[model samples]
Target: MEILRLDSFSFRYPHTQRCALKDITLSADEGDFVLLCGASGSGKSTLLENLKPELRRNGERTGEITCLGRPLQSLSRMESACDIGFVMQNLEAQLVADTVRGELCFGLESLGFPPEVIRRRVAEMASYFGLGKLLNRSVNTLSGGEKQLVSLASVLSLSPKLLLLDEPASQLDPVAARELFSMLARINSELGITILLAEHHTEELFTLCSKAVLLHNGQVSFCGAPREAARFITQNRTLSSDAIPPQTKESGSAYVFTSLLPSAAKIFPDEPSLPLSVREGRALFKQKISGRTPPAPMPVIPPTAPPAVSVTDVYFGYGSKDTLLFHDLSLTLYEGELSAVMGANGSGKSTLLKLLCGLLKPKRGTIELFGKRGAKPTLGYLPQNPRLLFLADTVQQDLTACAENLRLLHPEERIQSLSEALGISDILSSHPYDISAGELQRAALAKVLLSSPRLLLLDEPTKALDPFAKSKLAALLRGLVQSGVTVLFASHDTEFCASYCDRCALLFDGQTAATGAPAQFFGGNVFYSTAAARIAAGFSYDSVTCGEVRNLWIK
Candidate 1:
């Protein structure tokens, strides 16, 4: 049975000349897991909103949408609410109640379910989503990942047949994200619910999803099996090629899927089969290197230079001393270097960033700048939610306002330079609220960079960006570091931190548990490592990237 279908769907937001979604025709059969992919502003989110009538944005729309063989427009309010469940990218935006139990009950109660039925369904959902321990916990106290899980559980309590998820795991750590995907797979397989997901994090999902819908310039570019989509994408050499798995990118072979990249490295380009997961990749590697010698140990970076930002015996918390988050924590960031902080959700990564950026004060500690006494460095901070940084209607207005506030003599030139560098020149006139999440992040970063801060802090900067955009951001941050700006960012992207950052720090139990170069930092971690690192374990020492492993084996 066809669970959902769209015919020649075209939509344009109010006051916009171009269509956000142009003639998009797509469909999903019952029990299908469809992944919707595109570059920033390519209309993935807009198309998702169109699928759920209640969530659709006010726009000029022309299309025919069908759900469960009935016209979507003709479905009654109760039917729509009970059949389609939509989970947003921003978890906080969807949460309404104060506690976990309350949030789970809100949806069921709203739909006029009996009290006993609502209670039973809420308990089942909490157990299914692992929210039982947090039933009485305040929603505000939950971590980003926990909040997202709760939001998902709440939607599931309504017992919808079809689920629409928009960048659902953009805020979660790698472990949490993998768990969420696994849960989604189970839901599709056991419950027979149709799932349509719009997301940028494609690494693990490529193997999990049955089909993919690739959108570009507000149109359906390709819609097919995951493997076929990977081949087509690689052959075309589009900027979205980064969305292909790292191994697939390395092989440059349209014949193989991205999921098999790790195992592809262990074999020649002419190999008949490639492994998609680490277990298979490791088996392939064992066959290739039966008696090979392991590579020599790599040198570690020594911390000899003076620190740029230093914290000594920091003790901080939200309110009272009993609620401490950072307990006697100490850290150091060197000048002209990019450092990445990683940890489990709610491990105080964001709190550390806030303290470093002067958004909060330490209860009993000292944070010194530039290794100088009583000195404060000019700072720039980009919060996890970039929308908080925007105050104006349009991107142009926000940038212009920032420049004016900073008293730049040539504000126009600065705005143009940032606009071009961030690849957001086209959306300069668009309202900040109307742009895509990736575009908004870049816009906010541009707004912060206008002041020319020496020390920069970013919280989950790559949360919603495509792989190409992430690469661009890495290069941009490297350039900034080379230009004498020090950067400290909190991220859950292990591959990104291992590949791009100069150093990686693990924040655990209110302190810096481990800190070292990316190679050493990730090499020591067991579960927290990347796919490349896991696959290349036997052949190379401290090789945490596919490129590193490939270069050594090719010789």
Candidate 2:
């Protein structure tokens, strides 16, 4: 049965001329797992928020919405609260309690559940989500991924029939993201709960989703089975000029959306059928390269460049009583290099960046910037939460302030160039908080670049970006590196690191476990590698990125 339905729904935020969602007619059946996907600011989040009345934005809304055979707006507050659950993109925004246990019990208590029942539900959620050890831990000390899990558990404790998630795995590592997806699948299959998730990371989800919906410019471009949706997207790129929409054609939305597909889909777009997973991709790859010789391995060159940032036996921790998060940690970043620091959640990736940017001082170690022991060099740092970087109300104002404060020459030209490159030119007049998370990330990056820092440090730089924006960022960073700037970023995006970064460092148990070239680093790992590497591995190929695999196949 259809549990929810919308008939020609339209919504426009206050003070905005364009509707955020336009003529959207959609439905979700009971126990269905629907995948919502689109480019940044494409109205996926807006639609999701509109479904939950309590969280819906103040907007000019029109049309009919039904839930369980009744009007959505007619449902009682308690009924809606108990039937629909939402997990927001920002993990910290939803968490309320101090400890994991308390957070799990918050929703239950709010609804005035019996103490015994609340206890039972909390225990079950904690055990099910593997939060047993963290139950007593402070929520403030939890990593972004851990906090996300806690928020999910808290929502699940309410036993809602329908779950809505926005980029739930954006902050999770590969293994953890896989596990989260698996858990979500089980919830849909075993528990019979319907799920509608909006996410950019569709590699694993593409195969799991019962249905996929693609949105573009506030409209449903495609809504069908996942496989059919994949084929439609790939096939649409070859359509005639008149067949495509003018705005879409000009923006190359087809190409941008194609990049959001799975690596196998991207690599074999013209195939009779696209493979959705690495296993199937490997099988197809083996057949394609059956009689062909593998490409020669790329040479590994040792770095002879001077050090840009050096850390010697660093020890650091948060508060006075907190245990040391980093002990005897040492690493070096050479000039004109783009390096990535990757590790599991709570493994100190953000902490290491903070130390390098002088936001946090090491307890017992030496940190030198450009061969000086205590010198402070010009640098740009983008934190995990892009909202923290915003000082002015509007994006345009914030960027202008940044450029002016830095005494940049020709500030208007610089701002305009960066805004266009980062795809934030249209939203410059909007408030910084009004834009999408991905848009906000790019805006923050534009501000950071306005400084023209010699060294750049980023924490989770690709947290909410789509594939097209990532490519733009990669090209921008490449240009910076060519101009003799050095960059060090911490991320959980193994695919981005493998494709664009020069070196990858793995941090485990408070120290650098391994650091080497991307090919040698990700290619050597089993679970921590990209899908392209895993697919190529079947043919004894060491290709770690889709570009490399595509180039080799072409050759």
Candidate 3:
């Protein structure tokens, strides 16, 4: 039975001329795991929000929406709240309670559940999601992944029949993300709940989803089975090459939507059938590389430049009474290189960046910049939450203020260039909060780059960026590195680190566990590696990115 359907749905936000979603016709059956995908600002979030009446944006909407065999707009508040559950991309925004247990009980209590019933539900959720130790922990103290899990459990505690998720794994590490997806699969398969998820990370989800929907410029571009959708996108990209913008054509693929395809699908776009899993990709790779000699491994050259930022035996924590997050952690970042600091959630990656930027002083040991202890150098720091960087109402206002405050010459010219380069020129007039997460990330980055700092520090820089935007960011960072700026960023995106960063440092047990070039770092990793690296592992090539795999095949 069809649990939900949208017929000719079109919506436009207030004060906006263009529609956010246009003529969107879609449906989801009971127990169906539907994957919704597209580039940044492609109406994915807008559509998801509209589906949940309580969270829907104030917009000019025209359409027929049916839920559980009734018009969606006519559903009572109680029916809407208990039957449909929504999880937002920003975990902090959805969580309101102080503790994990409180969060799980918030919804049930609001709905007038008895204390005994709430206790049983909360207990079940805690045990099922392994929240036993964290039940009483403060939500603010939890890591990003932990917060995400808590948010999901809180929503599930209400026992909704349908779940709407927006980039649920955007903030999680690879292993955590896989586990979250596995749990979501179980929720759909075993419990018979319907799930509609909007995400850019489709590698693991494509094979699990029963159906796929692709949106472009506020319209439904493709809707079909996951495999057929991949084939359609590949064919469309080839046939419409001339229609692609000149700027994006050089990126190899025309449409940013194609970047949402699985790595194997991207590597073999012309194949009769695209591979969606590592097992399938390895088989295809073996068949293609049969009787071919493997290429020599790339040489690893250590940087000779002086240390831009050095941390020696640093110890830090939130308070004197709190447990130390970093215990004698030491690391070095050389000048004129882009380095990535990666570790599991709550492993002090963000805390380390704060110490380098002087936002938080180390409790023990020392941090030095350019050989000087406590010397405040010109630096740029982008925190994990990009929303914190915006002070002005509009994006343009924020960026202009940043430039003027820095006393930069030709402020308008610099702003124009950066905005255009970041692909946020169109949203300059809009409020920073009004843009999509990916767009907001670029806007924050624009503000940081306007300063022209000698050293750059970023935490989770690629948190919400699409693949095309990621490529652009990689190129932009490469240009900055060539011009003598040093960069150190902490991230959970192993794929981006493997593909673009100069070095990969893994933090474990409150210290640098291993640090090396991408080939040597991710090449040795099993669960922490990229799909391309795992697929090419059979040939012993140590290729860690799709581009490397493609180049190897061409040679």
In order, the Cα lDDT scores of the candidates are 0.82, 0.86, 0.87
- Scored by lDDT, the top model is 3
Measured against the true structure, the TM-scores of the candidates, in listed sequence, are 0.93, 0.95, 0.95
Q: For residues 1-555, could you state the per-residue lDDT of candidate 2 as single tens digits?
A: 999899999999989999989999999999999999888898989999988989988979999989878998998888888899999998888999999999998888998999999989989998888999999999998877788889988998888888999999888988888888998998899889999999989989998999999988889888999989888887766432111111243754455577678888776667887787887878888777878887666677888999888888999987874798899898887899999999999899989988888888899999998899988888999999999999897999999998888888899999999998888999999999988999999999999989889999988888888776787899899999999899999988988898889888899988989988988888788988989888888554468877666555656
Q: Which 10-residue window in model 3 sums to the lowest lDDT?
A: 238-247
Better of 1 and 3 by TM-score: 3
lDDT of 3 at 458: 87
**Following a full C-alpha superposition, what root-mean-square deviation does model 1 have from the true structure?**
3.4
lDDT of 3 at 332: 86
Pairs of colliding residues, candidate 3: none
Error of 1 at 344 (Å): 1.1
TM-score of 2: 0.95
Superposition error at 135 for model 1 (Å): 1.2
Q: Answer with 2 or 3, whichever has the higher lDDT.
A: 3
TM-score of 3: 0.95
Point out the higher-scoring one by TM-score: 1 or 2. 2
| Candidate 1 lDDT by residue in tens digits, 1-555 | 888999998999998899999998989999999998877788889888888889888989898888989999998898888889999988889999999999999988888899999989988998888889999999999987789888988888888889999999889998889888899999999899899998876767777899988877788878898766755655543222222333333444331223222223323222344344567666766676667778888987587757988889999888676988899999887988899999999999998998887788889999888887457678899999999988888999989988999999999998998888787898999898889999999999999899989999999998888765677688889989999899999999897898799988898889999998989888888878887778777667597876665555555
Give candidate 1 regions above 4 Å deviation. 238-274, 288-290
